[model samples]
Target: MNTTPFRAGHVAVIGRPNVGKSTLTNALVGAHVAIVSPRPQTTRHRLIGIASYSEGQIVMVDTPGLHRDFGSANATAMHKWMNKAARGALDGVDAALLVVRAGQWEEADEYAYQALQRESLPVMLVINQVDRIVDKDQLLPYVAEVTKDREFAAVALISALKRKGLKELTRDILKLLPEQEAIYPEDEITDKSQRFLAAEMVREQVMRQLGEELPYATTVEIESFEVDGTMLRIGAVIWVERNGQKAIVIGKGGERLRDIGTQARLQMERLFGTKVFLQTWVRVREGWSGDERALRAFGYHD
Candidate 1:
């Protein structure tokens, strides 16, 4: 057999909604491979997290959280459909990282716990948001409860916000990984393209600025992306459900659009390491969510 000191494999990070799973995946990958927000159901699909090391590489899959409803088309009618989509991300993972929030586990946690019970895969129970707990003693009990599950290879407490214990957690993940050839080239960090990433960064900025139902109802598509010398020219369409929403996004004299463009351009510049000129247009796409063709055209459903 061909021998290399370093090994690589996929580790799935699964948990309930809004449990800092995306943040932790970003921290572990050493870049913004996945988007993070305080909003639940922020992640819609399985995102890859790659960690490079001297001995091996760890590819972490940050999955959409297991929940009753994911605010998608199947949200109310067939929740099992959403659950199947969430669980599909866990298949064939070499290891699993279970992210649990500190303090009392909620009813949603049971869904996650039961899901884990069905898996024989090696798991690492991660206690996220440790900074929120004022007393260190209060943390131990929950950790104990998680360890009792017997599916866990180990239990860890960490604060994704404060970036505590992430190094050790990284080491633990590496240790649990099975010896396999690197699935991805060492230089490649993510599966998404530059244009897709730019669109996501803009969407994230819009979510932060607008908040509420706007974040849920809005979607961004990159109409065009081109680089000329040191400047990056980008065109994107922001789709909202109703005419009023479009008016709100555009604002008077296109003021809000300007705000969105400015924030997105700044972030994109930092990410691409070049100056960016971003142009955005707001369009009302009624029934876009239910229209499969519209979803495909916007690159939402693949």
Candidate 2:
């Protein structure tokens, strides 16, 4: 089975919360395959982003951040799922890209280092958010610290938001990839379906417009999706932890909620390439964060 063109396999991009893992995955794939926001754990599921070059294809797995200290059942499950996605889903990956924030290492870095050590996998150390640093020389010490581990194949600095050093990094990654056949069909963009992306897009909108407090306590689920010729009819529910937050999301006279709906509709229209009829409702799911059943209903595992 010469899967040469199928240069298709999983490559996991992992790091602590808000380290630009999602940003990098989106940048590499040249699309918004994974949702991005300032909030931690914005990415709760493992998303596959495909980046195809004339020579090969790289399917990158963007997992949720590893929250080492979360003790709640839901948080623990999330953390375990993240590690499982990396180890199990990306087991035979040609290589791993370990993303770290630039400037200095922290306790999280130590944990990441130890995790990489156990895998015995070749790692590419990426110092993300270099655009935040003014002096190029300042990044050298960080590079030096990472290269101290002989397990690293190469080190590169990048700003995922600005798309810097991505080309070179992709080239290096492709070089290390095995000569396998493409794992996906040529036009396939992600492992998730349009329904999932629609839910995520709405969630991203909620996070972006509703601000931090409400966003973290919120989850969106698409209850129904129907495509009829020239338009898409979507029924969605937005879950908030409390009654007051529900009022806030729905807004005064439903103004804010309407605005959110308008924004989401436009994006969905563009994504689906058709007219979108989006209807939203709010629900009060007390302590939804701790509710295993609620999480599962919203597509997170128990």
Show where candidate 2 strays beyond 4 Å.
Answer: 1-6, 71-89
Model 2, range 1-302, lDDT digits (tens) per residue? 65434245567787777899999998988888888888876887888888887667888988777555643354644455555554454466667787888987777766766676677567788889999998988777767766675467788788999999999988878766777778887677688988888888888888888766675788889999998888889988998989999999998999988888888888877766789999999999788776666677788762
TM-scores of all candidate predictions against the true structure: 0.90, 0.90
Model 1: per-residue Cα lDDT over 1-302, one tens digit each:
63545668888888898898889988877777677767776676567878777668888888778885554555632233335656876788888888889875777777786787787788788889899899889777867765664567888889987889988887787788777677887777777788988888778777777767575677789999998898999998899889989988888999988898898888888767799989998998886765657766777543
- Using TM-score as the measure, the top candidate is 2
Cα lDDT, all candidates: 0.78, 0.79
Each model's Cα RMSD: 3.0, 3.0
Which run of 10 residues does model 1 get worst, by summed lDDT? 76-85
Clashes of each: 1, 8
